[model samples]
Target chain A: MKTNVKVLDCTIRDGGLVNNWDFDVDFVRDLYDSLNAAGVDYMEIGYKNSPKLVDTEGVGPWRFCEDDFIREVIPEKKNTKLSAIVDIGRVEVDDILPCEESSIDLIRVACYLKDIDKAIDLVEAFNKLGYETSINIMAVSNSLGLGLNEALKKVNESPVDMAYIVDSYGSLYNKDIQYLIETFKKYAPNKKLGIHTHNNLQMAFSNTIFSYEQGVEFLDTSIFGMGRGAGNCPTELILGYLNSTKYDVRPILRVIENRLLPLREKLEWGYNTAYAITGLFNEHPRSAIAIRKSNAKNNFLGFYDKLSSVETHEDIK
Target chain B: MKTNVKVLDCTIRDGGLVNNWDFDVDFVRDLYDSLNAAGVDYMEIGYKNSPKLVDTEGVGPWRFCEDDFIREVIPEKKNTKLSAIVDIGRVEVDDILPCEESSIDLIRVACYLKDIDKAIDLVEAFNKLGYETSINIMAVSNSLGLGLNEALKKVNESPVDMAYIVDSYGSLYNKDIQYLIETFKKYAPNKKLGIHTHNNLQMAFSNTIFSYEQGVEFLDTSIFGMGRGAGNCPTELILGYLNSTKYDVRPILRVIENRLLPLREKLEWGYNTAYAITGLFNEHPRSAIAIRKSNAKNNFLGFYDKLSSVETHEDIK
Candidate 1:
C-alpha cells in the first residue's frame, strides 16, 4: 500500500546554518546520489537566497544555490526531486527561474509570522512558475493563539501546495505538536500539512512521527540529523519508521557513516543540556550556542539563572 | 492536583555499566544531595550484590554497597530516598541489612524472567524487612510473546510494589512500548508499571513520556544519559517535561554539567549510527560497542552490512 507521507531530506539547507554552507561539491553530489538511491521523495539541496541579498561573502555555493551550481551538483536528478529554501527578503525574484527551466522542483518559503505577506508573495511567484511551493511557518512555538491562526488562514487561502509546522526553536513537545496541528487544521484545512522538527528535547523523530500519525504528509529530515543547533530528525531513523519497500535504509546509512559522522566531532551538535535548557525556556538557542562555544560550557547554573528566575514556577500544564 | 508518578534515578547503578562504578566519593555524595534538592522521588545509590558472591576485582564500592558506605554518603537523609539493585545470583541473603536498619529504603531486584522464582524470594525477604521492592524485567524487548506474560503472571502474585518495562538492549519503539505495556497490563493488572529505556534509537525520553501518559509511574533516568552503551533517558529532559514546581531542573542540570559532562569526553555514549543499526535489528549492542571501541567508530555502513544482509527486508511492521 502506498503511504500518505513524504520524507524531505534537508541536510544541505538546515546543516548549512552550522558551517555557513561550506560543504564540498563532491560531498553534496554524493549526498544527492545517496538520498536518491535511498528513495527519499524530496532532497532540499540548499537555499535559493541570493548571496548579495544575505551579504554572504565567505559562504559556499550551497548558501546561494545558483542554477548552474545546482545542475553541476546533481547532473541528472533521479528519484529524489531537488528543492531549495528561499528566505523572504533574501532572494531576488529573477534568480528563481520557471520550474521547467530550473533544476529545483520545489521552492519553500521560510518566514516569520511578521513576514508572512512576503512569504505568500514569493509562494505565489513560485507557484506561477510551475514549481511546487511550501510556506514554512518558522518558529511556530513562539507565535501561538490568534497570530498563528491568522497566518494559517492566509496560507490556507494562498496557492502554496504545502504548509509546514516548523519548530525552529526546538522547544515543542508531543502535546504541543498535537495542539498546534489541531489549530493548524482548523485554519488551514485546504493545505497539505508538513512538519519540520529539531532535537533540542530529543523529540524530533517522535514529534515528526506524531505529525505523520496526525496526517501531516511532508516530513523534513537530515542524514544523521545534521542540521543547526540540536539538529533535525535523523533520516535513517524516520526511514526505519516509514519502512517503505522503496526506501532502502542502507544508502541513508552509507551517507551518514561516510559523510556526516566525522563532521559531528568538529561541529558538536545534537542533544546537549545547553540546548535542552533553551528548549525548556522556549527562547532562541543563541544563549545556549554561546555557552557551547565558551570555555564555561559546563556552567549550567549560570545559564539557568539567565533563563529562569528565583520565583519558582508552579505551572506544569 | 498531585501527579501519580515517581522519578527513579539510576545514575550510580545504570551508569556503573560504563565506568564500573568508579565514581569519586564526592561525586556520588553530591549527586545524592542534588537529586534530593531537585525533588526526585528516589535515587538508586548502587548495587546490593555481594562482592564474595560475584568475585568482583576492580569494581568499586558501588558494586558491593555496604550499609556503612550508605551512611557515609547521605549523613543527613533528605527528600529523595535511596535504593539499590540486587542481581539474583550475585547477592547473599545475609549481606542485606534490614531496610529500616540500613540507609536503603528500596531494594529492586534486577533479573531475567527465568529467575522470577529467585527474584520473588529476594522480594519477600526485602519486604519482611519493611522495604519497598520492585522486580525489574530487564531486556523486555527480546522476550515479547509468551515468555513475558508468564513472567508478569508470576510478578503479579509476588510482593513487589513496581514492575519495570526495561529495554536493556537500547531498542524498542513507541508502538512497541504501547503494545508491551498492554501485554504487561493484561497479566499483571495489580502491579504499578515502571519504565526503563535506553537511547540507542534516541527514543528514550519520548518513549518514557509515552509510558507516563499511558499510566506507567516510576521512570528510570540518569544525568546526561550516562549508562551502558547508548545510555538512558536523560533525567533533566524528563524533569523539564514533568514541569512541576516541586522539581528543580537547575539542580539536575548543575550535577550533570559539573559531574557528567566531563565524563562524556572520556566515555562515549548516546545515539549513533552503529547503535541505531543495532536498535533497528533488535540485536545485542556488543558488536556496536566493539565498533565504537575500535578505530572505525564512524564506519556506520560497515557496521550496517555486518548486522544486516544484502537481501532487502520487507519485514518492518
Candidate 2:
C-alpha cells in the first residue's frame, strides 16, 4: 500500500491557518527534512497566493508563501518533492515559476465550482512552466452535479496531472467519497486522484481509507491533525495503518515531537465537542468554530436543533 | 435515530479506570439526576466484579464497586435505569442479589471467548433474578474464529436480552465491525445488538455510525471519551449526528461540564498518537499505554517494525 499510494504532508501549509502561519524558518526546515526521511512523496510548503490579492495587511506568512522563502527554508531538497497551493483568485499568474528554476515540483490550484475556468488557466500556466499540476475542486460537498461534470470535462481537456476531491467543509461520508471517486474516475480516467480531508466529523481518516480502497493514488495529511477546524487527517494514522516496511514513521514522529507538539500547546485544535457536534449534524463548522473562539457557552441542544431544522447550504454563509 | 436507539452512559464506570473511581457520592448523585433529566436510557454506575478477584486493593473507588457502595451512591431511582458489569471469572455467583430487591436494572456479564460458559451461567442467574441481562464478549479481537462460533452458539441458546460486539482492543475498522454485526445477527437473530467502541484508532465514532446503519439498537459512550486505552466513543458525537429532536444533547453537555471536563483535566485518557498507532496496527495498546505511563522515549521505527512483524491478531493482548 505504501509503495502504491503517495503521502503528501501539509502540516506547515494547512496548519498555518490554525496558527496564523507564525512558524519560523527552522521549523519549516526541520519539517522538510523529517518528511523527506519519513518517505513522504510531497510536502505542501504553503499557499502560493499573492499577498496583494488577499488583503496582505492582516494576512500571515502562510497566506502568501514566496518561492524565495521556500528556497531559503529548504536549502537542500531530499527525497520529498515540494508542492504549493494557489487559490483561484488569491494568486496572480506572475507568481508561478518553472520547476527547474524553483524547488516546487507541483503547483495545486484550489477553486470553488464557479472558478473552474480560472483554476484551469492556472493549471495550464503551471504546466507550461514545466511543473506538475493539480486542480482541487474545493467545497465539493456543495458542488452542483453538473458543475462537477463540467469541471471533470475541463480537467480532461487540461494538462493537469492530478484531480483532487477537497472536502473543504469536512462534510463527506464514506458513501459520498465512494460516489466522488467513481465520478472522478469516470470523467478523468487517466488523471490521478488526490484526497484532502478535514476532521470536522472525525471521518477524515475513514474517508481517506475508503478513497484508498477505491484506488486513489495521493493522500493528504498533517502532523497531529494540525489544519483548519478539527484539522486534516493525521499523517501518522495513515502511516501506521499502511504497515509497510519501507515506510519509516520515525521521521514523522520526530516532526510531531519537535514542531507540532509545541504548536498544539499554543493553538487549540482537533476533535472537540463543538467540532464533533458540527460533523454529526452535517453542518458547516462555523458555529463550532465560533463557539470555540468566543468561549460562548455551548448549547448542544440548540445547536443540534438548528442544524437539524436547516438544510446545510453549499455556501456556509 | 436517537429516539429509537438507546444510549448507555458509562462515564462513572469506564471513567473510573482512568480516575480510580474516587468520585464522591455527591458527583454520582448529580450524574444520576443529570443523566435521567437528559433522557439517557441507561447509566452504568460501576463494575460489580469482586475486588478479591483482581487484586484491586487501594485502587480507585470504582475499581471495587460493591453492591452496598452502589446502593449508598444512588439513593433514588429515576427514569434512567442502572447497569453494572461483572467479569466472568472476576465475580462470585453468591455476590449478586436479584434486581427486584436492588435498584440495579441491568446485569451485564463480560467474558473472554473462552469464558462464555461462565458468562452464560451468570447471565442466566441474573435473568432468573428478573434483571435484564447482556453478555459482553470482551477482548473480542483476541477470539479465535472457532471460539467466536462457539460463543455465538451459546448466545443463541442463552436467554440474554442483548449481546455486545465489544472492540476491546480498539482495533476494528468499519469492515471489521460490519462483519461482527452481521455475524452476531446471523447467530442471535432475536437478540438486541449493542456496540462498544474505543477511540484508539479514531474510528470509534465512524464504527458506531456503521453499526447504527446496520440496525444496532444500543450504543455505549462515555462523556468526553474517558475510558481505558483511547477511551470510548464520545457521546456528544453520537447525539449530534443522530440529529433527533427527541434526544436533547444539553443534558450530556451538562454532564461534561459538571463532571467529565474537570475530570479530564485531572485524569488522562484520549486519542493520542501512540494509541492511534496501536489501533491502526490492530494490536494491543500495551506499548502505547506504557509510553503514556512512563513518558518513555518513543522509538517509532523500532516500534513500527516490531508491530508490523506480528501477525494481525484481533485480541487486545
Candidate 3:
C-alpha cells in the first residue's frame, strides 16, 4: 500500500549478535534468494568491520564480509541490494572498495550519540566510494534531550543518505517513538528517517507500522525476529503488513519453514521476562542476556527484584 | 500512569479455550492470589455457561463456574473482583444468582453482531440481578460498517456498564484500533470501552496500549498470554508499562515461573506463522488451528498457500 517504503531484512546482520555470525553460506544464499523473490528492497548480510582491527577466531565469514567471500556466497546479485553494517571504530576506509567493484550496495554506520561525528566521517567515506550510506544512532532512548538534538544536527550536516532512530534498548512506546520521529525530522530535515526496533515489550512490529504511518522510509526487520536479546521486528510480520502486490509473503514463509525454524531449535531469541524488565527501565539488555546464560535463566522474579534493587540504590545518590 | 484504567486478568476464561478448562483447583487459587497481590482490578474466572445447554464432556469446572465451586476456590475475597463471561444462547437466566449471593462481581455477555439483542437481554437480566455487565462483541473485525454502528447504538441504550472492541481474529493493526475506538465512542457514548486482543500479529499488548491512549478504560490480559491459538496480551507486559505503584509485576512473574512456564510445556500457544496468516486474512483461526493439530504443523508455506488458494477460489465466485 505504501510506495516509498523500503523493507530491509537484517536477519544475518542483527542475528549475528546472538550466534556470532556463524551462519553458513548455503543458508545465507537461500535467504538472499528468498528475500529477492519476496521483493524486499535490501538484505543486510552482516557487519563490514575490519578483521585487522578486531579478533575473529571463531566468528563466521559475515563478521568482516569481504567482497570476495560475498561474491562466492551470492554470485548473482538480484533486486534485493546487499548491505553490511560498520561500527564506528571497528571499520576502516581502506577496507571498503568502490561500489562499482564490490558486491555490496550499501554501507551503514552504527554508533552512539557521542560518536555521531565519527559515524558521519565513515558515512562520508562510504559516500565518496559511491555506496549508499546510513547513520544508525544506537540506543537513542538513552541519548535524549539536548544531546540527541546536537547529534541530529551533526548528522543533518553530513552526506549520509538516511538517519535511523534505533531503539537499541527496546524501551520506547508509541509516544516515545512519535516524539523521537518529530525531533529527528525537526533537527535533521535533510536526512530520510528509518526505524529499527526491538521486541522487548512486543512492540516491535506494531511500532514499525506506527513509524511507517508517521513517514519513516526504511523499516528494519529480521526473519522470525532473530537478533540479540528480545530481537528485532519479524520480517514476515512487516511484509504481511505492507499488503502490496509488490511484496510476496510466501517466500518469507518458505524461508522460515526451511531455514529459520530449524535454527530456532538450536538458538533462543525472543521476548522473555528478563528482556522486558530491561526495556521497562530503558536500559541495555546486557544484564538480562548475562542472566539468561546463567543457571538462573528462568528466575524472572529474582531478576525483577535485582533490577528494582539497583534502581533503589541509584535513587540513594 | 493512568488513574481511570482498570486491569482485568482473563487467564482462566480465555485460556480455558486451549485446555478445555482443565485447570486444577490449586492452580486457579494460586492465580487468584497472585492477581490480587498484583493489584489487578478484575479476574475473569471463566464462563458461566449452562452445562445442560452445551456438551460438557471432557470439560473442566470452569465451563460451568458454579458459585459453590468459585467460593470453594476463593474463600475470601480480596481487592480484586471476580467476573464471568457467557455466550448468548449457552446460558440461562436462572443459572446466574444475585450478585450479593454470588461471588462474581461482573457478568460479561459475548456475542456476534446478530446476537447483540440477545446479549443486551442477558446484560439487562444480569444488571437487574445487581451485577455489573458488559457486552463483548465477538469477532468484531468481521462486524464493521452499519452493523457495528447499530449494535453500539443498541448497546448505548442498555444497562451494560461497558462495551468491548474484541479483535477475535487478531486481524487489526493500530490504525484499525484507533478507528474502532473512535467509532465505538461515537456510537456508544454512554458506555465505557474495553479492549480484548489476540497475538496472531503480535499486536495485542501494543494495540491495548494504543486503545488506552484513545480513552478505552478496561484492559484485558492473560498471564504469559495463556489463551487459545496465538493467546492474549501478557499480563506482565501491560503491568510493566503502567509503571504504577498500585500494581506489582513480581507476583505475575512468580506465577509464570512456577505455573505458566510448566503449563507451556504441555500446551502449545502464542504467535506462529499459521496464526499470523489467519490474522492477515481477517479470518477465524480455525483452519490454522486444525492444521496445527495435523501432522503438517511445520509446513508454514503449505498453510500460507492453502489460505491464498482459498482467497483465489473465492475471487472466482
Taken over the whole model, the C-alpha lDDT of each candidate is: 0.87, 0.81, 0.92
Question: Which has the higher lDDT value, candidate number 2 or candidate number 3?
Answer: 3
Model 2 bad stretches (over 4 Å): A57-61, A186-190, A281-287, A297-317, B2-4, B51-56, B59-72, B297-317
Best-fitting candidate, scored by DockQ: 3
True lDDT of residue B72, candidate 3: 93
Clashing pairs in 2: B20-B60, B21-B62, B141-B314, B141-B315, B142-B314, B142-B315
lDDT of 3: 0.92
Residue-level lDDT of model 1, residues B1-317, one tens digit each, is 13888999998898997888898899999999899899999999889899888868888889888999879877889889999999988899876888878989999999877788999999999999889999998877767888889989999998899998999877788889999899878999999999999998889999999999999999999888888888999999888999988788888888877788778879887777788888887866777889998998877878888777735533221
Q: Itemize residue pairs with steric clashes in candidate 3.
A: none
> Model 2, range B1-317, lDDT digits (tens) per residue?
63468888888888887767778888888888877877778989888877678877657666556767777887668789999888767887777777777778998887878778888889888899899989988767667477787789889899999999999779888888888888898878889999999988788888888888889999998777888879998777777667676556777777776677777787779888778767766677777777777745344545556667877554433
Candidates arranged by TM-score, highest first: 3, 1, 2
TM-score of chain B of 3: 0.98
Tell me each candidate's TM-score.
0.95, 0.91, 0.98
